[model samples]
Target chain A: MERETILSVRDLDVKFSLRGRKLNALRGVSLDLYKGESLAIVGESGSGKSVFVKTFMGLLDANGWIDGGSITYKGEDLTKYTTEKQWLGIRGKEIAMVLQDPMTSLNPLKTIGAQIIEAIELHQNLHGEAARKEMLSVLTDVGITEPERRAKQYPHEFSGGMRQRVVIAIAVACRPQVLICDEPTTALDVTIQAQILHLIRDLKEKYNLTTVYITHDLGVVANVADRIAVMYAGDIVEIGLCEEVFYEPKHPYTWALLSSLPQLGVKGEPLYSIHGTPPNLFYEVKGDAFAPRNPQALKIDFVKRPPYFDVSPTHKARTWLLDPRAPKIDPPEAVRKLATEGVKGYA
Target chain B: MPENENREVLLSVRDMSVCFGKGKRIFKAVNNVSFDIFKGETFGLVGESGSGKTTIGRAIIRINPTTSGDVIFKGQKINGKISKELDRRVTREIQMIFQDPMASLNERAKVDYIVSEGLYSGERISEEERKRRVEKALQEVGLLPEFASRFPHEFSGGQRQRIGVARALIMQPDFIIADEPISALDVSIRAQVLNLLSELQKERGLTYLFISHDLSVMRFICDRIAVIHKGVLVELAETEKLFAHPLHPYTRALLSAIPLPDPVREKNKVLEVYDPTQHDYSVDKPSWVEIEEGHMVWGNEKELNRYRDMLKA
Candidate 1:
């Protein structure tokens, strides 16, 4: 089945000149987003997951520049459209984004309802009574009670969960084709996090919108992601169906990520964390970015970057271990047990 | 209970209650919260936003005044219009590490001054002694000795937290209250800080009132667990027992809510929110009752019996 592609990114490269040194934030990262499918980009901090998404929304700081890449949305090149007028039409209308901190994204002076209504009016041609009516409907749809009164309430008046809900209401107010959520529930409590995830999932289905969820927490990605992209340093090391990625991971970095997850039933020992910090992006890498941290790194892995080796029809990983000539290796016992019990058949 | 019964009791808080505002519109932030932190043991306080865990931590260090309650340290009450002598004693014995290191630490103050601030108040000490203590504290937290001259803004989130810990530990406090110390840190740096805290606790025989919303981190570090909801102490039990078999419904709900790292368990598990309305708190008076050895739950006998029956079913 060939799904219609909503957005296609090719050879996206972002670099920052910090203290006279050029730091490559995103290096030749390419991916496709189909309509109504949720894609999760998983990595530790400084993996450029946030940078890639920020580029799409034109929210990157002045120091960052796209050296080479094309982000095509509906066959239109987004990188070339650098004018504020072009961005104003696309942002918060065709595509909306929700940031990690709800408080910062929301206006402190304005009421929650008023802020959402502003977004509605800016994108959609709703005005006065019509905008108010639509704002109430959107608030109610996002599971917020007393839409009439809450419309008058400010951001500080609502709890963390309620504020996030208001943020969601505003994001979805214009019926955006894509929602870029960057760690939307990271700061929230677990119960509230669950509600937010459920709300995002429900809204995605109701509106038939594509979603790009960026987060460090694999637990969040497991429940929501249809496909997962394992990013390291500034590159996508692996991309696969969620089930295959969780069950039979080919990349050593992906295996490490799986083992580090703390599970409910596993009781023998503490969760294993990936030792050593991620490599500095300021320096250029000759080979694999994860080779320094990967315990099973081969000589070829250090000298030359491995091409994406196909593991299955839907799975591919960038590692020398996936090569036919390379020595076979197995994931740690803890990860295997977790895969068998918890993560297998995730798709 | 006898006053001088056990030397193992490092800090005891009795009937601690704190209220904001006054008169008819008063809000009880903390209600009759009483718990003991043993010497050389980590006491975990887990709760949500409005649970008053932070308030309890603040009250113990005298950062804020308690409405009514005795914060007893080494068998002496230190609360309600404290004297300078008592304040000095409390400051020496108890220290606090705040959640946001950037906000807690003075941006303009150099690392040397920040670390020496605690020792500065104690007694007159030579410059050589101060330098030695500051260097030792910084080294203990894995920071460079030369960093003592740098300001807080120069350091990363993790390094700033290490500075915060160094500042608190230089006083050599018997009991330390860490209020969500690692919540602001990066995930990779979190384990490093936790390991450092654990190592420090073992070396110094320090008692910690570790307050955080993270159950997994608490499970790893804390010896005993106390669950607070709203303004009430809901449950208190040993860490292993609490994680293994949570008795209180709220505790169970909280435990289930922790998002496990495993994708499989994460998918299969359904975390339920804690609803106070479901429980019957109709009893005119409620008290803490021992459900088992070393496990205490707050509720009336009728409610306990009902809960027990429900669990059995």
Candidate 2:
């Protein structure tokens, strides 16, 4: 199926000034967000997955700035948005964000209904009873049992799962074309996490909104995401269809990430783990940033950076192992089984 | 796990209940829970937040007072008004590793002091011997010995968590109560900590009461697992047995809710929502029963009979 690109990012570089030192949070990252597709960016903390999406809504910190490249959406260069006034036009109506912690996301002072109405009035141009009506509908849309009574309650009265639903309601109230959920289910329980994921997918279909999920947990996004992007050291090491990334992963980092899952582990053996920490962004990264920690790193991986190699028409990875001249190396045993027998091998 | 008769029961909680507040505002966090953890095995307690899994762990470690029932560790009741010698023994033999390493450790104090804090309470040791023990603990948890001098703010999340483990291991505890130990860690880092814990268990023959909400990790590490909901244990069986035959509705619901790593299987999976109102317990009260050998479930007589037939089928 041919799909249209909703947003295109090219060689985007984001840097933060921390304690008088330049930190390269995002280093020459590029990707395309397709219309109405759910793309998941998987990485550990400080891997720049959050920073990458923060650029879309101009949500970068005061000390952080876009150093280079462009973010093109709806025939406009988003990187050129300098003022909050200019960004206000694209922030909520075009793109909305649901943050990780629902406890801090909502106002404890105000009622849940009033908060959703505020978003509707600010973005949807509705007011008074109409805005209130829209807020109630949004609450009902998010699976709240009693919309009328729940609207009158404060955030403290709701459970963690319920509070997350309110946060989603507020985001959905803006009626944005694209919705970004940053670790939406990390703070929630397993049963509630599954329900919230299902709610997000349903909301996406109902509104025809393109969705982006940013999480460190790969298991949480397997069922929800249509595509997967593996990020390491502020770079997109691999991007592919969900099945391709899980089954036929090429990057050693991707293999390590897949093999590190506890679900793929044997009872008596140690689970696969990355040995060292991520490279410090304050210093210049040489060649591949993940090479120092990657056990299967090729010799040249430390000298020169690898370019994106096409594994298929829809899948691409950045690794020296993909080069024809590189020696053959096998991924971990678990990852090999993922390729041969799919996720069933571990199951 | 070995046969029940052959293996020794390391810790047994009989009708344990933990309550909070008093009078009309009273709350029972754990209501009449009972289980036995065998020696040299990881006993898992799986439940959601507010399910009293953490509360049970706290009660075992004497952080929370139990209003009723008893906690017997090696054939001795170790709760409420114990003797001074027994108190000292309990303090030394049982240690807890708290969740959220970022908050568990003292930010102002150096790692050396935080780890040796327990040692000072029991027996007095020379400063040189304390330092040596600290170094050994750090090395066992895969941290550099030099890190003992640095404050917790200097370490990353995983490193700080390792410090927490070192602090617990330094006590040479026989049983460890780990409360959501790896939940605050990154995915790759969780593997490292889990491997360290299992290795330490093998070397020391430690029994662990592992309390967590993540079932996937529990399946990997736990020998026997118990499913708890709203302070009540609904099922208890070996890890594989519980997964294969979930007799309780809540257990089945939780199992169905776990997001599989496989996309195709996940997409095809059907979710089960458990409703408490499904059981007409107003007339027929519920009780814990061993429906099969070593497999327990909480249900009334009618529901227990139905479960037996389902298990057979």
Candidate 3:
């Protein structure tokens, strides 16, 4: 489907003023989220996956500010957004964020109904009776049965799964164009997680939500993401369609991440662990940030930064190995088999 | 006979139940759970949070008192209040590694003191001997000698977990109750910790009552597994057999719910949602029944026959 890009991020750079030093959290990160498609931003802690989304929503902390780049949503550039007036217009009305923990995201004192109604009234022009109706409808739409009764109950009355549903209900109350979920299911049980994933997928179709999912769980990514953005060290090392990134991965970092997954069922076989820690963000990053951990790192990888090389028309990777002049080296045997005769052939 | 059957039974739990609160508020967190761990094997207790898997681990170590049933370690029943001599014997034979290393380790204490906490109780070792044992325990968990002086805050999550492992290893216990040791660590760190654990187990010939919500990790490490749901033992079998042929509805649902690393399989997967209402358990009381050789399922006569037919088919 050739859908219109709902949000187009370009040359995005974000930094935080920690202590006396300026730490670059996101560098040259770009992504184009399409209408009614889920884009997953995957990375470890401090990889700037959260920072990238926070920038688009104008939710970046006080110490941190956008260094450069533009996040073009609708006709507005989100980078220029500052004042409470501008952020209020965009934050929940245009783009809504669902964090990992629902407890912190929700107001414990207020009832779930009040929160949803408040969000709806703030964004849409619904008032009193109409607002209550809209809020209840949204609550039901997010698969919360008996919306009337649930609305009267506090967040504490609901289970973790139900609370998350209420959180989703609140996110969709304003009927935002984009829904940004940051590890929403990491804290939930696996069974509950499946239900939540199903709920989100249903909501995406029902509301035509352009969803940007920030998670480290590749399995969850495979199920929901139409496209996958593999982030490493404040950089999007690879970005492509879910199929392209999984089956025909071009970046060595993507390969390592894929191989490190524990669900392969290769019993008793020593599982692969990615060597070395992520580059310290305190100092200036030279060349490829992953080059130190890259087993197939070339001499040029240390000296020069690799540009995004095209694997396919839709797929690109930022690794020296992707360069035409670089030596021909295949990913590990497991990853090679995954790229070729792999489960990508299945669902 | 398999080697497990012939080998000495390390720990055997008989109809153990753990309940909390009183009267109307009474809740049985673990209900009549029975399972056995053989020598030098990883016995996994798989369940979701609040399912009482953690409670079972705690009950075996006598941390949370078991309301009913007996716990036999090395053919001797050890449950409830016992003599100090018996308590010391139990303490020496078993040790526990908690889920959160940060919370379990005292933030104010140094690494060496935390690791050698078990020794301070009964053992009358000299300062030199204590230092040597602590260092050896730290080394076994893949920590450095230099780490002994630093406080808990100084080490990373995985390193802190290693310290937790070192604390447990200080006693050199035959059995270790590892309660979700690697769940908190990052993926890369998880593998490193798991490898370290497996290496330590092999080196010491250790028996682990490995408890975790992550079935994927359980499959990677456990020799045998028992699935728990709402404080009841739903299924028990060898890891490979359990994965291949899950009999209970809960076990099947749990398996299908586990997202695989493979994108293709994950994308095409049909997730099985297990609902308790789907089963007709009102007619006959459900209990643990051996459905196949070395495989147990918690079900009534009707469910067992259905499971048997399903297996035959």
Q: Looking at model 2 chain A, which ten-residue stretch has the lowest summed lDDT?
A: A338-347
Q: Which ranking of candidates, highest TM-score first?
A: 2, 3, 1
| lDDT score at residue B97, model 2, on the 0-100 scale | 92
lDDT rank order = 2, 3, 1
Write one digit per residue (lDDT tens) for candidate 2, span B1-313: 5787789998999999999999999999999999999999999999999999999998988989999999999999998779999989999899999899999999899999999899999889999999999999999998999998899999999999899999999999999999999999989899999999999999999999999998889999999999999999999999989888888999999998888787777788888889988999888899999999899999998999999998999
Best by TM-score: 2
Local accuracy of candidate 3 as per-residue lDDT tens digits, A1-347 = 47798899999988899987899898888888887888999988779999899988778898998889899989789888778888888888889989999878889999999999999888898999999999989988988899999899999998899999999998998889999999999989999999999999999989888899999888789888888999998999999999899888888888888877775426667788888788888788889899899878899888888999998888899988877788999887767777666632111
Task: Supply the TM-score for candidate 3.
Answer: 0.97
Candidate 1 Cα misplacement greater than 4 A, ranges: A259-276, A294-296, A341-347, B1-7, B81-83, B279-283, B310-313
Q: Which scores higher on DockQ, 1 or 2? A: 2
User: Between candidates 2 and 3, which one is better according to lDDT?
Assistant: 2
Q: lDDT by residue for model 3 over B192-247, one digit each (tens)?
A: 88888888888889999999999888888999999999999999999888988888
True contacts kept of each: 0.28, 0.71, 0.56
Deviation from native of the Cα of residue A210 in model 3, angstroms: 0.3
lDDT (CA) per prediction:
0.84, 0.92, 0.87
Where in model 2 is the C-alpha error above 4 Å? A342-347
